[model samples]
Target: MLSLHANVYAHPEGAATGPRRELRGLPLPTLVGPGGGPPPFLQVLPVTFEQMQAALAELPRCDCEPDGFFLLTGHTPEGVFWRLNGHMQEYQPEDADGPSMHRIELNGECPVASLDAVLRTIGWPKAQLAFELVREGVTLIEADFREYASQPATEGEPRRPDRGASRVPAPCRGRDDAALGTSALEANASYTPWHITFGTYGTRLHGDRRPTVDLEHNEYGTPYLPRNELRRRRAEDTLTGPPVHLSAEQRRLIERLLPEICHRGGWRIHTAAAQSDHVHVICDVRSEVHGEKVRRLIKRWLSEALNEKWPDPNRLRWWAVQGSNKAIKDESYLQNAIAYVEKQRTASR
Candidate 1:
């Protein structure tokens, strides 16, 4: 079973506009075929509050109470089901008296076959879906499924909402192709891996000339900036702390700690290298685990280990907050990334 979280906004023209209604612990059931088989792929099943309530009562209960709506897509003969649990929160739009916006925070699981169908059922355009997965709140592992479009949509099928009609602003539309493209380096789904690169805190390289927070530069490649100017700026800026230089022993310690960290996280490390001021890794994680979360876990665990080993008087900073995470699209890209990390040497400058 794959776990997913989603934030869906209801369009003002098509959504409920009266006082908020609370329907906790509802079971939303999907429409079934004449023979009681699973609903056809991409079929929109209208979910009601009462059905959600009923479904909630029948399903196994956890400690947390269901605080939102539910949608059942289909059921398999093997006793498996595709379901969505959504918690509704109301927000006021820019116009004070305008129709209230409903933001549903959804969490649930389904068979992998239902992923593309569920997304298409939600009526989000492909571009918006990709952008939200990569840069939106809580990077999603399911975002990798953006490649699912390779499968043709059911022909002559009319698009419909999984629940109710809701129009959302198309934020990712009109963006460059590169921005919307899947980070997965390969077209094949099974072999995808992530290539990550991060820098130690206070480390400055001559090539690190781009402004840190520029999302546009990140979407496209960074523009040309003079190496001399970047180095000069680094010398003049007092805020950027001194560059970190790990000793031979420190590097050895990192090599030992990284594999341990990866093992604890259930991630398979393909290759990992710790340079004087930076680190590079290529690893495979659960399809549901996003790169950002994995990067954070590694940074946290290693920082803890390093701090315990060397207690500093002044707080010893370990890593830069942001890192490069590129999905390995194919075997060729994966091999190249692994080679790059393994063969990298300390910069001469």
Candidate 2:
């Protein structure tokens, strides 16, 4: 049976069940295969930026061996950030600039369990990174081929079959409607586009990038900490801060991948923007698709696609080990997200 330790609160006098009770647990169960087979050995490789680029290039010709898959992660630099407090604090343009983009350490025990779960917790910066890696990985495996049409015969007399036999040439039908009767096909005469545009991401101006390190705080509360203590706490949290300027090449890559990702997840992208360090997307929940699944889909797809030509799985290694799924149940939150995405212009603007 699957079980773990439960924390039961006791009275100050030592009697049980007086104040609080919390539940915690050890590893629950080895939920792997149905009945239980051998413990699955998941092969994990941490790829670097140059390595990832190489992997992406080589991916086109390489064969994907059975029982093998990989995860991609990327990271930003660390630093201190000062907030803009209305007009009282002068917001300098230089403050908008931070550090150059680079990969973070991915070894040791990952804080989260899986790549998909980590994305949901931290939001889109990590998701964008994972998406970039997965796209390259995917490209390595499959070519993005455009649909081609057959040309009419250059010169030929339309051959007539033996009419006495009673066989007739069939009427042309849409690929999907070929099996339908002529009467049914006539009832639905409108032509529908073969592919749908569920979402998009791009910058209007050339080289426009977006800033990261957004700050939001509760306005209702004023903490009573002494001046020195407050500064000390903030300093402690300053390590591994946000990234500064991101390359235009990185931004463009994300723009191409987001829409493709939405299509793969069976979800519609209401709006999307590829910023310097983070990406913003306003998407509707596909009844069948959840956030965590979307995160994984993007990560794996981008990594594989990029790695195809680059042959380096580690170029864009910013994702956390695990990503989480978040549900947007309210319309207001969706609106705000969309607005935010629309306003993201790089410092140059």
In the range 1-349, model 1's lDDT, one tens digit per residue, is 5544544432222111122211112122222222433222221123333343444444432111222333334455686654544443333335545222233344455555554443443344341322111112211123333332222333432323233222233221111222222334334434337876677765644345643321232222455334567564654473333556776667778877787777676667798888877787788865655565577567756866886787442443566655666676688878888888777633311
Q: Number of backbone collisions per candidate, in order?
A: 13, 72
lDDT of 2 by residue, 82-184 (tens): 1100000011123334221122212111112222232222232222221101111110000100000011112331233222321111211101112221222
Q: Which of the numbered candidates is closest to the native, going by highest lDDT? A: 1
Task: Name the runs in model 1 displaced over 4 angstroms.
Answer: 1-191, 205-241, 345-349
Segments in model 2 whose C-alpha atoms lie over 4 Å from true places: 1-246, 309-318, 322-325, 345-349
- Model 1 is weakest, by summed lDDT over 10 consecutive residues, at 131-140
TM-score of each: 0.41, 0.31
Worst 10 residues of 2 by lDDT: 140-149
* Candidate lDDT values, in order: 0.47, 0.29
